[model samples]
Structure formats: C-alpha cells, structure tokens
Target: MSKPSRLWSIVDRRIHPPLLPLTTQDSQRLLDTIKNSFRAQLEKEHGLTDTIQATPSTTATNKVQSISNATTEPPRAFARPTDQHLHSILKNPLFSHQQQLKRQVVPASSVESDKMIFKQAVAKGLMNITRAHGFLLKVAGQKNTEPPVAKIENHGVGTLVLEWLRDSGQHRGLKWFSSSPEFGGLLIRFLLAEGHDELLLIWLDQLMTKEVSLGATGEWGITSMVFRELIKAKTLDPTLDDAYRTFLTGMNMLEGYSLSGKFFSTAWRELCWSTTVLAWKYPKVPAHLFEPFAASKLAKDPRDPRAHELPLAHLGLHHPEKPSVELALEWLRRHSFGYPAKMLLPAGSLEMARCLERLTSFGIDTAQHLLLSNQEEEAKGVMEYVKKITKILREKDHGLLPEAAP
Candidate 1:
C-alpha cells in the first residue's frame, strides 16, 4: 500500500535555536529568580498571601503587599531523630525493665554471636566500642581493661579480641570523598597481625587510590615491615610441603606488594632482609630472580643470634622423618657456599644422642657426609649456634653438661 498523501504535504517547521549557555551574570539572575520563586511558593503553601505579579518582579526592585495573616516564620531543621534521641524518647522506665530484666547474652566468639548482635553493634556503635577496646588492649598497651562485659577467659579473650578486631576494625566507610585515614592504618596493622596479609593489601589499594593526601610511607611504615616478618615466620614451619606455597599465594594477591619497597628499610633490613627479598618475587618470579639472593645472602648468612629462630643448617641435619633429603641437601649446598669452611669438633652428650638417632635412621654415609661437610670445627660451630638458639631440652633431660652436649 502507498503511504498516505492526504496529510496536506506537511506544514513548514522551524528549528528552535539551541539553548544559550548561561554567562555568570545570567546564572546569577537565574539563581535569584529560582530563590524568589521558591520563597513565594513556600509563602503560598503556608497561607502567607502576597500581591506578587503574573511576571514576578525582583524583590530588590519592588515591595509587594504582605497578607494580614502573615507573621514571622519559625526556624526550620530541628534535631534529627538519632539513636540517642530515640533512646531518650522511647526508653523511660518502660524499656529499662525490658532491656535489663533480660540481659543480652553476648557470644564468646563472634563465631557464636548472632545476626542481631552483629547488626546492633553495627547500628548502635557497640561493635566499634568492643573493637576499639580490644585493639587498645592488644596494640595500644600491655595493661588492657576488660570489655564492659567480656566473658572470655584464658587465651580465649586474646584470641577472640584479635579475631574481632580483624573482622570489624575497618568497617570501610568515608565521611567525605576521602576515607578515614586513621582507620586505614589501624586496619592494615590489625590484618597483618592476624596473618591476613591479603586483607592488608586490599586496604592499601583503597587508601592509595581513594585518598591521595594520605602519606604513603607514614601510617604504612609498621604495616609493611610486619608483612615481611609474617611471611618469614610462616616459612619456618618444619612441615613445609611446598616451601613457597603460602608466600607465593600471599604475594600474588591483589594489591600485594603495594608497600613492599617502603617496608624494606634499614631498621628492619638486617632482621628481615632475606625474608623481604624472598617475599618480593613470590608468585611471579622469573626463576633466576632468586638465584643471586639465595647464592649471596642466604648462603653467606644462615645463623641468627635469636636462639629461638629456625636455622637452615639445623633443618639440614636430616632424620628420615625430618625435612626432605633433597631440601636438606639444597640448603646444605647453600650453607657450604656461604660458610665456605666448617668447624666440626669433638662430641657432646646431646650431640651424641642426636647423632645416634640420625645414625640409626639415616645411615652412616649421611652422618659422615654431614660430619665431613662441616669438619670438626665447623660441626662444633653450627652445633654451638643451634645450642645458642634452642632450649636443648634433651640436654637437661639427660643431665648432660653443655661441654658433652656439643
């Protein structure tokens, strides 16, 4: 079918000009007009009559006649009904009996705390109170006061306190365009403490991108150092099935290593230098990246003065049930390269006992290889280093003198 032509071939249409951009003066005029219109509307709505014209005249140019009923307007914007105000209004003697007659049974672990406590703590700010109290006790000082009604006993309190702070401390929020910088720092520190290194990275990413004014190196100093040490401590696990598993996962995490360079400073360098280097390349290493450090630093220095520390050499003195022979041998290779020479020496009673156990399980060649690797002088040196760090419980149990336990 043909299109309809009966529609008078259409009348001529005119295109309106595009809306003109307002200049500053035009904008001021418009704003003034809007304000006056709003005020007139309010007056009309509130029964305050005025002789405003069809074309509204500027109040600055003319005075309109006011209505006989018009009076001074009362102030606007009274106090908002906040929780405290609501409590004052709703609470009377009525709720006190209800609130107290049945006390809220708070849980020992938030694992046990119900949805209502979580919501109330969130809404009423009591959760923040408990979190801040817990943080203040744990991080702020050694002498911590109990939460108003903390029910934790023994290590239960410390463990639960740490858990609560980790989950609740950085209840992410912003009062303005920027986040709470104070909360960010505390959140990062608490996450690192709880071994939540991944969470720390996420927090840093938010701070860096959202708030440029926050000093990157200022509040972040201790947090970065803590991440390095935490990974180092984890690697010392005697049952390391995959030596790099935890570290690699943590480093590859989103926003991970955001503050790594700042963390590698002089104060923490000696204590955590090797650890920091290992953590730096974690999941994305090119394989050869670790070669230099493994060859240079770890090989050169395997002993720490802190007697409680795990020594690579001690881990290398393998029993069948101990660390892998391959790992022990690799560590031993690095040890020899760094140490250069051994100081193996005469036997001590404790050494005799360990030697006997190793000999019984790992055979003579392994012992002799170990004994031969560190000649008497070097063996004695490493054994002494081990003694310096370990409690030597076997020595005490067997009543062996330190001299014979060498």
Candidate 2:
C-alpha cells in the first residue's frame, strides 16, 4: 500500500496540471501576439517590407481608369463592300468597260443549286411520308390516326417526286431510293393507305427483280418488309392467302438468278422462322407451300451447318400439323449421317423422342390403311420400320425411353 500510493502521487503531479481561466486583457494580448507572428512570417517569405500598401493619389487612379476604359471598348461591326470597292476588284485596267459589262451580265448556271434543292426535297418528302403515317404523333403525346389518304391524294407529293425523278432521267437516284428499305417500306405503307394492293405487288416484284445490289447482308431489305407486310395483311384477312403464296412464288423464282439467288437463299434461311409462324397460324394451308423450301438443295446441303437444322426442325416442332415431319423423316432417311439426322437422333434427344412418337402414330395410321386394303406385306413393313426406329432411339438413351414410350 505505501509503495503504490507513492507512485500514484508522482504520476498525478507530472501528468495533470491545475486549470486556470484567462481575463479579457489576457485573451486580447494572446490574439495580438499570434497576428503579429503570422504577418511577420508572410512578409519575410514574400520579401515585403509592409503587409499593406499605401493608397495611390487621385490623379493616378483616374489615369488607370481611363486606360481600362480604352482597352475595354467594344469592337466595330463589319461593313459591306461598296460599289467602288467592287469596281476596283472586278474592273481589270486592261479590259474595256463594254467587255467588263458583258462579262458581269452573263448569268451563272443554277444547275448545281437545282440539284441540291431536289435532293433536299426528296429528303423532306421522305420525312413527310413518315409523318403522314403518324410517325410524329407519338412524340406529340397523341394517339396515332390512320394516314390521311385524302391529303396524300390531293397533294400527290410522292407521285410528283417519282415523276420528276423519272422525267429528269435521275435513274440512279430513283433506283437507289426505291431499293432503300426505309423508302420501300414507306412506299408500301403509302400504297396500302391508298388501297393499291395490285400496285404494291407490282412494285414489290420490280424491286425484287431490279439489278441494284442488295445492300449489306442481314439488313432486312425490301424483300423482308414485303414478307412482313404480306404476313400482317394475311393475319387481318385470311382470304389473302393467294397474296402470300404469290410472294413466296416470286421469292422462289429469284433462286434462279445468280446474284439475286445468293441473296434469296440467305433471306430464305433467315425467314424460315417467320414462315414457321405463318404456317402455324394457318394449318389448313397445304404442306406443299413449304415443301419446295424443305426439299430445296439448300436445305439439304451438308456443307452449310445451318442448312438442314432450321427449316426442317422448325417445321417438325412448330408446323407439326402439316406434312413437315414427314418431310423431315424422309430427309433423315436419305442423309442418315448428316448434321440434321445427327440432331434428330442424338444431339436433340428430347426432340428426337417427340419425332419418334409422331412417326409411330403416322406409321400406325398407314399400317391400318394397308390392312384395310388387304396389303399385309406393306403393313408389316411399315410396322417393322416404326419398331426399328423406336428400338434404335431407345438404345440411344435408355433413361428417356420410359418417359417417351406410350
């Protein structure tokens, strides 16, 4: 106890000091000392004798003000060239007055200006076409209304533009503009607004047949828009089946042209999904409508990885009501080791299971018909073919057979 008390007494005395309050005079003195020290430091560092400078005389101040005023004055505006200036520049001393007058009076050609104005007019007309179709109505917070057919007919803006292009021999411009999907789509809409279905089809045919290079691959050019619009029209009116069929025929016809055929094949592959959707909507449409596509060499070509997989798979899965699955089975039978058959048999196990079910049902139906006709041998073959396929598929995936088997 004595040793500990002695150590604590020494620590308290060394570490803790007595608190003391300062008077007003003491606080003022402390602040003056700090201010003097800071000012002295700043003056020493900046090489200044005094922290504040003396004010200038009234005359010096006035001189400075006048100098600032002179420097801050606004710049003068530019002036136009006078007739004298123009004459000095234009009247060469070597030429006579009559020759100079004749040269000045000769008119400048306005051809370039007219061409620029025509191009601007074409751009504006295209914009107006979109506006006529309610392109801007959404921007103005308004519901879209039908295109003003009466106004379009009265103005004849599109017609007049086309006529000018044709009459003025602007064939290149006309062809490029007509081939543009933007312009082509607007023109189609305009024609539809005017109830010119026959004209629309004719224009579409011309566009498809034109020699112009189809711009940029995968761009969904004029042909794609034609199919889109035709599909939309078919959806609204089922009787327009012939319209779609006619367009398909036209597209198929393009397969014969060398340059256009390449484009058509690409477009055909891309639009296979759309065709599947269309076929699904109208199952009554005959299977032959798509048979040409499914049976096309392009669909069966082994070189293209995307060739056989899409068209037949889409038909089998989506357009099952048609003879699409039959077409797929026939394709598989022919190309047993090809990519598509690989997809049907192994890679797409679940899909292959479904196809087998459909094949079995189809086989049963045929076998029943054969039995009714007293063709026992043919019926046995059909049944045996169905059994062989089922056995092969079951051996491929034993786990799926229990769930897939009826």
Candidate 3:
C-alpha cells in the first residue's frame, strides 16, 4: 500500500479501537482526511493528462491567451474572425506563390509562335541575366511591350556569355551572375533538360533567395528534371532543416486550398484517410510530420471526406507503399541536398523489425533506378541511414534480452 493508505490505517487504529468504537468528532475527522486524499489523487491525474507538447508554431509553456471581453453580459457562444481576417487566413500563406506556380493556359488565339516566344524571351535578355542585374535594365527601361524581345536578338547575344564562363571554370563569375533570378529560371530549365538537380542546387541557394513576389502565391517550380540532377549528385535528407527551407520557397504549397479561398468541402476526410494510410505504413517512414499535415487538413467540417479520390492518387509513389503524390509534396517541403529515397529506410518507421524484414528483399538497383527515373537514391543520408538505424534496432533487442547468471 501507499503511504496515504498506511497513514490512514494508523490513524484509524489510534482513533477508533475496533471493539471500543470511535467518538463522533474523531470519526468525522478521519472520514474527511480520507476523502481529501482521494480528491487530491483525482486532481493529480487530470494535471498529468493536460500536459501539452511543444510544436513548431507553438511553445510548450504558452498558456493559451483568451481574447474574450471582460463583460458582465453573457459571452458569445463562439468566436469568429472579421471578413478581412478570414481572407488573410484563407489566402495569405500562399499569397506569394499563386498563379505563377500553376501552369498558365496558353491562349489559343495568341499569335506568338512557340519558337518566337522562346526566341523573344531569349532576346529580351530575359534568358541572359536577371531583371535585377541591369541585364534587363534596358528592356525594362523602355516603355514598350516589345522591348524585351529586341534586347535579346539585337544584342547578338546568340549565346549568354555566362554559359561559356560556367564551362570555363570561372567560379566567381558563375556565382555572381548565376545568382540572378532571370538566369536562375533559365538555368533551372536547362538543368532539367540535362538531368542535373545536384548541379542545380549549386545555384538553388541563390534561386531561393530571390525576391518572392508578395503577389498572393508562388510555386517552387523547379521541375522534376532538375530534381533528378540532384539525385544524381546524391544529397537529399528529409530532415527538419530541409523541411524549413521548403516552407520558405513556394514549394510546399498546401494543396487542399482552392482559388475561391475555401477548404474543398471534401478535403478534411480525405486528408485524414491519407494520414491514416501513412500511419498504417509503419516500418517505412514515421508519421511524425505527415501526421499533423494530414490532421490539420482533416476537417474544416469533420463530417465529410469531400474530395473524391483525395485528388492525390495520380501522383507517383517511390516505394510501393508510399503515396507518390504525398512524397512529392514532402520532397518539395525541403529535401535540401538529400536524396528522395531516405524515407525508405527501416528506422524511419514506427517499428524496427518490420523494416529489417522488408530490407532483406530491397531492390539492388535502387540508385540506378533513381538515375534512370531522375529522382536519386532514397531520401536520407545513405550511409548513416542504414547503419545508425541498424544500431538502434540492435540495441533495442539487446536491452530486451534476458541476462545470464553471473
């Protein structure tokens, strides 16, 4: 028994000798003490259950601030934001990355040929340098719609000198000039065509730093081709650091939001299903990050899974178990220089033994597949990905083993 119970026993024996019985006053006092102890135990358990963990946006010690009025009148049953406040919450997170990230529909009636369009973009010095570096200063200087095209062709800049500089091993020129936003976009396209994500990250640091348009949404539009190049170079860790960077760029666009600035009515339930699938796919990747993203979108109204098919099945999956669309999203959130395949490791899962069992039959040509498909090896630091996790599993089992007699 517990100390309180033992103390109660001692007090009971002292106050009320079993056959002699207790005086009414002593009996009442003893009952009160025992009742108080039970109440204290109940309060202690409630406090333990109420302990909250810290999250990225919220600190643990933050006592929730209530904005209610100190009125004698009855308080409003619910709190609601003002209309303008709703707009910011509904649209502001994607305020910088909108239209540009979505592929614009090329108008059928537009007269410009594809060749002419590319050539004009090239001519305006748009392809040559960024609008920031005075490369487009002259084009931007003219108060005409056609000036950008003229600068490209008239400059006899058939080829940008930066390419030659890049090839010639002039490091300073490449860094200074390549960091230009206009050049960064072209270079990204060029790298995609050539299959070079790793090489592209050489310039990605600069690309990410370019002024994000405060214009209500932007896309981290670095295409798959460029991502492939990085996989070739072998750097993608699906760690928190990479995830933070992804958030800064327009890459991790929250897909559930709509243009009309409403959560798709069916979105909540579908996202929950998606999160559940991730959680169920244990011994693959943990549900730590995935869980919340899924949960946050799970319900504008919990009574529905509004969108049919979750609208993500069409996206590709890497491991047979992973939902491809979700992985693509997570990767955009900041794989950094890490590979895309890190999520495949056993240690990433909730269970270790399952990962080990599955690893036994892992494909040998996974890296080659990445090279072929333009993705890259798995999503983690390759060496430690396997070794460190194996050690963790080994230690777990060792701890569980029974000791022999000395």
Candidate 4:
C-alpha cells in the first residue's frame, strides 16, 4: 500500500499567471448577481420573503430597497477599516494582560540596541580619558544624585557592582579608579587597580573562617598586601583581625609552588611582593605567622623552592617596628640593597640603631648565613651594612629592644 497524498501539496500549489485583476464596479455587480439568484431560489423553494410581513400591498419597500443597495455596493477606500483599527478590535485588554503575565519579556532587538549603546559609551569615555569614570558610572545605571563610587550594601548587587567597576577600572588610571571609597579605605590602590576587590573580600572572609580551600588565583599575595598596607597606615578597624586571620589561613593552603596549581602562574610574584611587604612591616604581625613566609621568600639557592622573587627595596622605614634580631637582620639586608641604600643620618636611623643593639644582644653569630646572601654583589655588602648598624647602636647606647607587644 502507498501513503496517502498530503493536502498541503494542493494547498501550496503555485499559480502560473497569478490572480486576475477585477474593477470595483465589476466585482460589485458580479457579487450582487450571485446573491440575487441565491435569494430568488431560496424564496421559491422555501417560500421565504425579504420582508417578514405577508401584506397584499408592499408597505416597507424603502427598507427592502435599502438592504438590497447595501449588499450590492462596493466599499469605498476612505470608509474601509485599516489594519490598526482591525487589530484594536481583535485585541482585548484582559487577554493582553494575561499574555504579559504568562511571559514577561522585552523585545530582543531593543536589548541588543541597549547593549550596543552601553559599549559605545564605555569606549568613548575610555578614549576621552577625562570622562571615562563619569561615562562608566552613568552607563552602569547610576543616577545623577548617586556618588560615582558607592558601597553597594546589598550583597548580590554589590558584588555585581564591584565586578563592573573592576573590569571597567582596569583600563583606566589608578587615580580615577581609586577615587571611590570602599572597605572604609583599607583597600590597596594597586589591588583596586586589579579590579577584584569583591571576590578578594569574599575570599578573605571565606579563608579566614576556614570555610574555603586555597582554591587558587594567587589570593595569598593580595591578602598579604592589604593587611601590610593597613598595618603600615595604622588604619585599625574592628573587622581587620578576622581579615588577617583569613590571609594566614590562605597562606597555609599552599602546599608549595607547582606548575599545575590554579592561578599559580600569576600569583607567585604577587605573593613574593606580599612577603617582602610583610617582612618590612613585621612587628604588626605574629612571629609564628611571619617567620615561615619571611624565610621562604628570602631563600638563597637558585634552585630553592621559593627562590623566584621580585626586588622591593624602595619602601623606606617609617614607624619602625621595635627592634629584634630577625627584624634587624632583614632590615639591614633590605637597606643594603643599592636601590634602597640606608640613609647616613635619617630620622629612622635611630630606630635602625636600636635594631642593631638588639641584634647584638641576641647574639649576631646566630643570624643565618643566607640572610644576607642574594646574588654575589648583594652578599658582599652584608658585613659592611651590619658594621654600620652596630656602630650606630654603640653610639646611641640604645641597647634594649622595645617591649614585645605590637
């Protein structure tokens, strides 16, 4: 047996010559002739009349004539219903409301238009330099009354805002991007330039509470820098303790550097930099936490596990930590670096003198050989720097270390 032919075959058949044109009057006349013939047949077969009354004399001829004329006449173009009028008549307000409720939607074309406008605005602002920040803020749905930089209080919204700021701020200068306030100003301007503050803070909280793994992205370095900067500035906020704890927790998660680790490639230098900053700002942190990081970053062997490091000797001493053997040794090594040579007679030289006294009291012989060992040149200058510190210590007669409290 064969399958039956589909009705669509006939329904979709193409016309060769297409439709024949008909004049309005001719069409009206043809329609009237067909209608009258049908009516006459119905009247003869069923005895139906145009009028309901069966009077011998026709009393409603005018009404019958008017009905006949209406069916026979062609509709005038000016009087015909437009598509808009037909749509209005066909659509009901209640039905439209129900449709909207079923699926709240914006037309895709409009959404695409909006996204394009946003991109163009961002590009223009970035290129102009002067208007970049203002343009970005406006495009992010910020109102005129709202500040350019805002603390998004709502967690979800704030996270989104931070993400936007991060991506947009990356291409702009540090000053323009850092102009906004966040975390009550504990943010490192450099990290802010990196545009990961929200996620950084989230990781900070998660790591602090041990709720998360050290899942990568070199978060350790940023956390370290943030804490170091905060300590250096003496910006004591109540939440800082928890934040610092998180940084320690994140540091512990690293099982030593490896090629396969997540975010490992980008995180090493950052973490190294953090270590340098922390070593400089040692007194503000716990000895136990600082010791391991300080030791690892200062490794002497080229093949040592933590040998790859960046130089950061430019940061000068300010509000120096109370003198200790470890602190003094690291200080001397850092100060000896040619890029940041110790000043001959600066304000903090007195603090350096005190550190030297403490180093001697603790017994300089105990200081590790690798403490001063960098490249050969760096190693050679170590004793000279140490002697200078010792001389200052003797001349100042500051033989005691400050109390062991931060």
Candidate 5:
C-alpha cells in the first residue's frame, strides 16, 4: 500500500494539475459537439446540404411515395383482341395494308396472325367465296413457316374452299384451284375422292393447257391418280374410251414439256398398264401406246437398257396375242447388240433358255445379234446356257420326245 500510494503521488505531482472525472451530462455534450463537426465537414465536401435545401420537400415526398407504390403494385397484362375485333380489323383496308407491310418486314408473327384472321373470317362468314379464294392464293404464294399444303388442309381452309366450290359449281372453281399448283393438286385429290369425273376430266383438259407446275414427283403422282381413276372407270364401264384417250392426249402434252426421265418412265409404265387393260377389254383401242415409248430416245440408250424391261415384260406377258410382242422383239433385236448378256437375258437361267428358244422360233438369233454387237463371249455364254437348259428339259420330258427310233 505504501509503494502504490507513493507511485500514484509522484505521477499526480508530475502533471501541473491532476485530471478529474467528468459528469454524465458533460460527456454527452462532448459527443454531441463531435457529431456536429463531422456532419458539417461531410456536407461541405459533398454539397448535399445545398441540394437538399433547394429541392421542394413536397416533391421529394411524392417521388418516394410513387416509388413505393410501383414496387407494391402488379403490372397490367396485354389484352388480346376478340375474334370479332380481329375480323373487323382485318376487314379494314388501312389495317390490312399495315398487316401486309408488317408481313414483309417480320413474317413470323404476321403470317400466323393473318392465317388466324383468315380462319376467323371464314368461320364467321365474313369473307365471300371469291374473296376467300383470292386470299388463299395469296397465302399459297407466300413463303410461310408452315407448309402450304399443311396450312391448307390442317386449318380446314381447304374444306371451306371445297364446300364453296361444290356449291358454286366447279367450272369457276377449277379456275380458282388452277391459280396455284398447291391448289391444283388439292383440287385433283378432292375431285378424285368425290368421284366428280366430269369435273375432273375438265380439270385434266385444262391442266394440259395451263402452265401450272406441280413438281416432278407431284405431277407424276397426280397423273397416276387420274390414270388409276380412269382405269377403274374403264374397268367398270368399258365405254369410257374417250376418257382414256383424253388422258393420253394430256399426258403426251405434258411429256413434251417435261425433261425428267422419271416423268417419262412413270408415264410409260402407267400407259403400259392402262394399255394392257384396254387391250383386254376393248380390242378396238389400239395397243400401240408403248410404240411411242419404244420410239422415244430413252429406249435407244444402251447404258440403261433395263428401263425397257418392265414395259416389254408387261406387253409380253399380258398381251402376248397382240403385235406388241413382235414390236418388242424387233426393239430387242435392234438394241440387243449393245446390251450385256446380263441385260440381254432374263434373270433366271430357265427363263433365259426358254426366251432364247422362243427367239429361235421367231427366226431371231439372239447369239448372232450379240456376236454382231462384238459381244462374242456373252454370245457363247448364251449358247451354252441354252444347250444346258434344253438338255435338262429333254431329260425331264423323255416321254414327250418320240421313243428312240430302233
């Protein structure tokens, strides 16, 4: 105790006046003074006091209230127009023009909306038949995200147009349908389905003259459907030869303009089938439809001689009694020289041997033709194959052959 008291006395004596503890009120006053000094320095550095003093307090309060309200409230959603409103809008010329312009700029939204509007108009009976037909043509011509065929069929628009055509008469409708290839194909399919033969015939007649272009395969399919219908009709009533002839003329006209080999082959195959049927049913109907195919340049090409096989086989098997076989044989003889033995002979050895024997009976030497064509090895092979099959047949038909002369 003595040492602590002496040390404290010495420290207190070192200062001129000893320190005294302050009251709570004096400490509070000091803290207040320090806070005021700091606030003044900050206001001077940032110029915040002047800004706050210049701003109207009422406006500041209003801005705060507005921000709070914005945060608390939900945003309003866009309202889609009703079908009636869309119909009215579509009917308005100015609105329609704007939509057309929008379509040119941004096709996605405009096309879908236009398609919807068109469907709505048709459903509400707002658009007339002619107007609807024109609209469909315009839509078909555009490059749309949806396929034109799918758009027409899936949307029931094709059905609506079909109904109008049926009610208004197909004469005018055929013109409407023929305005576009898409429509033309749809019209043919509809006509065939409904058995509207008279109108279909008129459509086919018009198709020959019209420059409407269904793509190669599309055109082929349409022709096949029509031919099948005509064949069916002919099979049912053999008096429809005029119908068949009209189709043939139409096909011939198409063939003139078509450059597709597939087109030619498809046409020839169909004609062969149809001609075979006709030959069976009506002997008066000339069996020479294949003559045009045989005469065509396609038949003369040596590289793809197999193209001629189906038509020839059709004629040889179905109309064996007709002169078509003789015509086919003459064609073969002329072209056989260029053909490989595989192409020249039938697929099966037995069939080939019998075919050669038939050629021999016809006084046409196939081996000789091959040799003349510079296919000597192939010619020898044909002769050997024929001898083998003949020996086999003789062994099998021993009784058919005369007893050995003894």
Candidate 6:
C-alpha cells in the first residue's frame, strides 16, 4: 500500500468482510475516494475551506491515476461574509451564544423569559391545576393590589378558581384560605368591596362548613368578616345566622372569651361604632352573648375610658332590660381606680347604693379606700354618701357601721 493509503487500511479492516482482504491498488483507490469525499463534506457542512496544501506523494498519485480516469474537483475558496450573510450567521446558535454571554453576566434572560412564559401559560390555561394554583399563590403574595392585566383579570382568575372548586370539589383551596387568613381576608375584602356579595356569600357558606380560625392578632376571623358584611347589607341574615353563631362560639373560645376585647385593642373606634350600630338595630341580642367579653381584661379596667364603654353605652342607652348597671358596677369592683367613687356615681342612686354596699361588705377599709381615693367634687359627694349611710346604720344599730367614721 502507498504511504498516504496506510490510514485507510485500518478503516478498510473494520468495514470489509472478514474473508476479503484489499490489495494495494484497491486500498489506494479507496483512500483517494475517501479523502476527496471527506473534504467536500467538511466544506459543505462547516463553511471551512481545506487548509492543507501538501501534494500527494508520487506513489499515491500513480495509484490514484491507475485506479480511475475521473478528474478530482479543486477545493472551493474560503467564504467571505456579506452584510446579510453575517447577519444570518449572527442569528445562528453559536454566534447567538457568544452574544448572550457578552450581554448578560448571569444570563438572566432565560430566567425572565421563563417567568413570562409561566405567566402566559397560566393565563392561557395551558398549565395543570397544581401549576395554576402555585401561580395564583405567587400572584396573591405579590404586593400589587390590582391584577397585572386589566382590573378584570383577577376577577376572572377568582371566578375561574371558584369554578374549579365547584367542578372538582377538592376543598384544598378552602384549606389554603383557612391556613393563610391574611391572604384570604384580602381576597374576601376585595370581593366584597367590589360588590361581589353573591360570590362572597357562596364562598363563605362553603368555608363555614369547615371550622374557621381567628387571625393571628385575635381580631376578626374570615367567617366574622363575611358574617359582618352580610349583616351590613341587611341580606342573608337567616342564611348567615348559623355561621355567625359558629363565629361567636369561636370568639368565646379565645383566652378571655371576648370578641369586644379582641376588637378593642386592635380597632377600638370600630368596635364602638359597630356595637352602637348593631345594638341599635338589634336590641334583643341576649346579654349572655356579651357576658364573656364583659369579664375580659379589655373590660376589667373602668379606668380605661374606652374599655367596655361601647357595650356599656349600648346596654345603658338602648337595652335597659339587660343588666347594664350591674355590669358597670362589676367593672368598678374589678378595677381599683384613681377615682373609684366617680365611676359608681354614673350608675344612678340605685346602683351607687349597691356598689357602696358591696364595698362595705368587703370591709370598712375597702369602703374608706373607695371614698378617699377621689378629690375635688367627687370626694365631697362620696363623703356625704358615707356620712348618710353611717348615720342610718348607727340608728339601725347594724354591725356594718365602723367605729371610726369619716
């Protein structure tokens, strides 16, 4: 075999039948054909010209001449890039890869592109329910109040979610809402504020089937807000009664068993206004319902001018049949005030007498403290009541009278 044909011998052994071995002439012919074919293919596929300039050895040339009479084609010149051709090359994957590396140090385009594609996929309903839910949660967690598209886009998504729940009846979304009350509350408020009360009512009824929890701050629960919203519209009270009772039951389960207390610290003014509005409209809500909250820390201190003031005002001003005066007096007894006598004076002569009797039962020292703790006009009124009570008691010769009187 010729010197240039030696490389083809190895290839020939792999391809040829085991029984057939190539002669020197056959090997040289195969070598010439293979080299020319390979060069043509490299130029056609890679746009690279053949760089090798060495001529074939005389033995290889003579072998090629003896093998075939066909003339070999000369190698094409190297390609020069015109503007359009260079533009096309730049658009190819390799050139584009280099361009991308130059533009983005971290290659954020794919990440951003992925985000956009994901959003589009969700918007187009191309994603599965799990993917859709994840996307919705991401959107919900975003700080934006308005939907990314037109204002109606969120409404559409909201409707779609509800419809999905209706079809699947999974209860997964409800569980999510219960677990994430803040996000759930935002969604609910948005729905109500947008006048989607029917939809709000529907979701609320569905949600109420499961136990609802209070928020982190012990403020209004999801059920409570929905219940209150229904109450505000003066619609669906009958439908919401069970839910409201359930909500109140949950409220009573709080550490102090107090809804008023829950709302007082978080939103004192709203509590007062809500109490007034509700009490005025529905005067017959049993006083027992208010009992739990009345005894809470929020209501224990009569010194707190705002504490329990609304419920007291509501009971005293509107629901006189209820134990308004007794609650006020209990408030007084529970709290040691800077001016204890003043709080008693507001409950009228009957309650005032009962409160004094209570203090006196505790002992002369307690009664003396209640009176002596005040100054100004209050002290004068307390002293006179003490004197009158002492004279009456001494006349009756009751052991309740103290030996040392004011």
Model 6: per-residue Cα lDDT over 17-132, one tens digit each:
97367777666766766775665665556665643422358646856874364224333333432324554454333223433333433425543444444434433445545554
Whole-structure CA lDDT of model 5: 0.46
After superposition of all CA atoms, the RMSD between model 3 and the true structure is 31.4
Higher-scoring candidate on TM-score, 1 or 4: 1
Order by lDDT, highest first: 2, 5, 6, 1, 4, 3
Q: List runs of model 4 lying over 4 Å from the truth.
A: 1-198, 201-243, 256-283, 295-323, 326-406
Give the per-residue lDDT digits (tens) of candidate 1, residues 1-406: 7764422222111112343455676556556555556656665766657624333354433334322221333323322223244545433322233444245466575434433333344344456543544443444333443211221123233233334443554444322112333333333333434555555445434544443445454533433444443344334333222233433333343124343333322212322222332222323323333332232222332233222122333323332223223543444344443321122213454444543343233222234445765565644544543443233433443454333323
Q: Model 5: per-residue lDDT, tens digit, 279-386?
A: 445444444553444355443223366655635633453432344344444554554433323323323446455444443332224455456668788667656654
Return the TM-score for each candidate structure: 0.31, 0.35, 0.18, 0.26, 0.30, 0.27
Give me the displacement of residue 51 in model 3, in angstroms: 62
List runs of model 2 lying over 4 Å from the truth: 1-183, 190-197, 204-240, 255-260, 265-271, 278-280, 296-308, 317-406
TM-score winner between 3 and 4, please give it. 4
Where in model 5 is the C-alpha error above 4 Å? 1-198, 205-224, 255-267, 277-281, 287-305, 313-406
Least accurate stretch of 10 residues (summed lDDT) in model 3? Answer: 256-265
**lDDT tens digits, residues 1-406, model 3?**
5466665675857566563577776666566666545545654655533322233235222323221222223434322123234544433222323333233344353222232333334334343333322332332243323212211222322123334334334434244432443444333333433444445555544333332222222222332222322222121222222322322221233332122112122223222322233323223333444434333432333233332222222113323344443433333334334322322334334434544432221222222334455655453333234455445445544464222211
Q: Residue 15 CA error for candidate 4 (Å)? A: 38
Instruction: Output candidate 4 Cα RMSD.
Output: 22.1
CA lDDT of each candidate?
0.37, 0.46, 0.34, 0.36, 0.46, 0.42
Badly placed stretches (over 4 Å) of model 3 are 1-283, 292-406
Q: Best-fitting candidate, measured by TM-score?
A: 2
Please, what are the lDDT tens digits per residue for candidate 2 over residues 53-113? 2223553685687557733545333122232344444322222234333333222534333
C-alpha lDDT of residue 96 in model 6:
31
Specify the poorest-scoring 10-residue window by lDDT in model 2.
147-156
lDDT score for residue 247 of model 4:
43
